[model samples]
Target: MNYQWYPGHMTKAKRMMQEDIKLIDLVIELVDARVPLSSRNPDIDELGKNKARLILLNKADLASDECNALWMAYFKTKGYFTVKVNSRNGSGIKAVEGAIQEACKEKIERDRRRGIKNRPVRAMVVGIPNVGKSTFINTFAGKACAKTGNKPGVTKGKQWIRLNKNTELLDTPGILWPKFEDQTVGLHLAMIGSIRDEILNVDELALELIKFLKEHYQGCLEERYGCSESGDVVSVLGEIAESRAGRLKGNELDYTKAAAILIDDFRIGRLGKITLEFP
Candidate 1:
């Protein structure tokens, strides 16, 4: 299957990221815990070079704990400070403040040496679309955060939300385009609802997902849909449809309805916390 992203939007996003990078001491990036490698656009590494970086594996609750740990170690090996987070429920969110301080210790110390004391660290949240970037920003900022309106000589209409005495966040999130050169990456993004479902053939994608689950998860389909582990994607899909009674007027066992059920199950974690890929 072929997937395409807009070059014009990518260019504009890159430009905006560069501008935002200039104004921050650290970059707090969010990646889906289930598909860390696929959910991330490493172009930020080039744009955010020489800046402190922290990777938040968001949606941790929906992903396998083992894979999340592996991704954390993998990113740490590459020099990024990593933390697993369930941003939707505020789990692991508290640790981020401390992580930020630690990530930017050098910058903080430099400011201290220059007679600048107690200036709040500036941070910008960035990620691919639909990776819970908005949810994270809202959770991180909390409802009580005051929107520090525009100040002179600092971009005419920029607004920063003051999180506390030690932190201030740019209200807007930096959106990076999903990486799509790899077919596996595209599939993972499609599975997560980041890529538009209308652009994909759910039946084909569901088949791939079935194959993955049968191989890696081993009996999730049996437990969830009371279907045998036949290792047959199409038949297993049919079983799911019959179990769920996904039928049309003639009751001819709709593969489309079955595919939708299978896809939604995987997307919403009904099949369990399964990670699609590693490293």
Candidate 2:
């Protein structure tokens, strides 16, 4: 699939982030653990230059534990303070404050030397759409300080939230890049729900997901939907439809409904922990 999605608001969001970055000491970027690289908008590196960086592998519960560790080490090697987080349940959220302090230790010490006491370290949460930016913010701040939604573009403007006396958070709308030069990146984003489902062919996307799972995570389909080990992806999807009772008025198998069910299963981790990308 030739995938590209850059809504008009993203242009304004980027411009706003450029201005907002100046007011923060750190950029707390969140990426989907299943597709870490694909879910990230690399523009943040330039926009947040000279700023302390923290990369939260948000929704880590949906991704393979092995991959999460590897991705954390990968980012650590590149100098980003990394954490695995499941924002929905606040798992690993408490550690974020210490991680932020560690990430900005130099800045904190600089202020100490200059005698600028009690200044809270400022941070802004950023990520591509639907990667759980708002959820992370709300969980980290211990309240519904930011609006939480499953759909993309739920956060339309910026809001600063004070976590404690030592830290403050600026929540910004998720921003996607203008173009996806690598189609694989686009596909990964679509699989993780960062891309809107309305503009996608769910059947084709499901097929791709099936193929990837079959290759990297053998037995996943058979375990979930009793799909046969051998056969084309379409046939496997058909088997899924039959097993899951995806039917229409005439009792015909509804591939579209089956596709939606399977995709939802993957997104919510009902199919078990899965990771779509490697380091």
Candidate 3:
């Protein structure tokens, strides 16, 4: 399936971010731990040039621990301060403050040299839709400072949140680029629910997921849905439908319902600590 979903507001968001980047001292970007590279917006590198960078692997609890370590090392090698965090439960949130200070240490020292004191570090939090930027803000700030939701595009505009006397965060709406040059990137985003479900084919997506699991995470499908994974993807989905008792009128197996169930299960991490990509 060809996956592409870029609304008009994203263009406006990108423009706003470009304008706001000048005021930001650091860019704190969030990427889904399961698909780190795919969830990142490529335009951010240009927009946030010359700024201190930090990458938070949000939803770290749902991804493999080994893979998370590799991702941290990968980003660190590229000069981005990296942290593994689960914004939902506040795990790894404490390390962010120290990482932020370390990332902006040079800026802090420059300000100190200029005789400026008590100036809060300005950071802009950005990511693609549904990657947990708002949740991280709320968790880190110890309050519901930004709107949080399970679906994409919950944050409509920019807001400034003062986390403490030493730090402030600029929360911006999650934005994706205009086009996905690599279709695999789009597919990875869709699997992680960063793209809206209304524009996707659920059955086809579920089949693609099944194919991945069969290759990388063998027996995951059979363990969760009691479905045999040896045959074609379509047959595996049929087995999943039968196992789940997903039947429509006339007692026909409802592949659509089964597909939705599998997708939901994966999104919530019910399948296992599975990462879609490796470093």
Best candidate (score: TM-score)? 1
* TM-score of every model versus the real structure: 0.96, 0.91, 0.91
Clashes of 2: 0
Candidate ranking under lDDT, highest first, comes to 3, 1, 2
lDDT per residue as tens, model 2, 29-98 = 9999999999888688888879999999999999999999999999999999999999999999988999
Worst 10 residues of 3 by lDDT: 146-155
| TM-score of model 3 vs. true structure | 0.91
lDDT of 3 by residue, 1-279 (tens): 899867566677777777777767999999999999999888898888899999999999999999999999999999999999999999999999999999999999999999999888988888888899878877898864443222232234556677877787775534545356899999999999978899999999999999999999998999999888999999999999998856899989999999999999999999999999999
lDDT score, candidate 1, position 59: 89
lDDT of 1 by residue, 1-279 (tens): 765554567777787787778888889989999988888886988988889999999989889998888899999999999988888899999999999999999989999999999998989899887898899999988988998887554565668899999999987745778546777788888888888888889888888888999989998899999998774888888888888856788868888878888889888889899898876
Query: What global local distance difference test value does model 3 have?
Result: 0.87
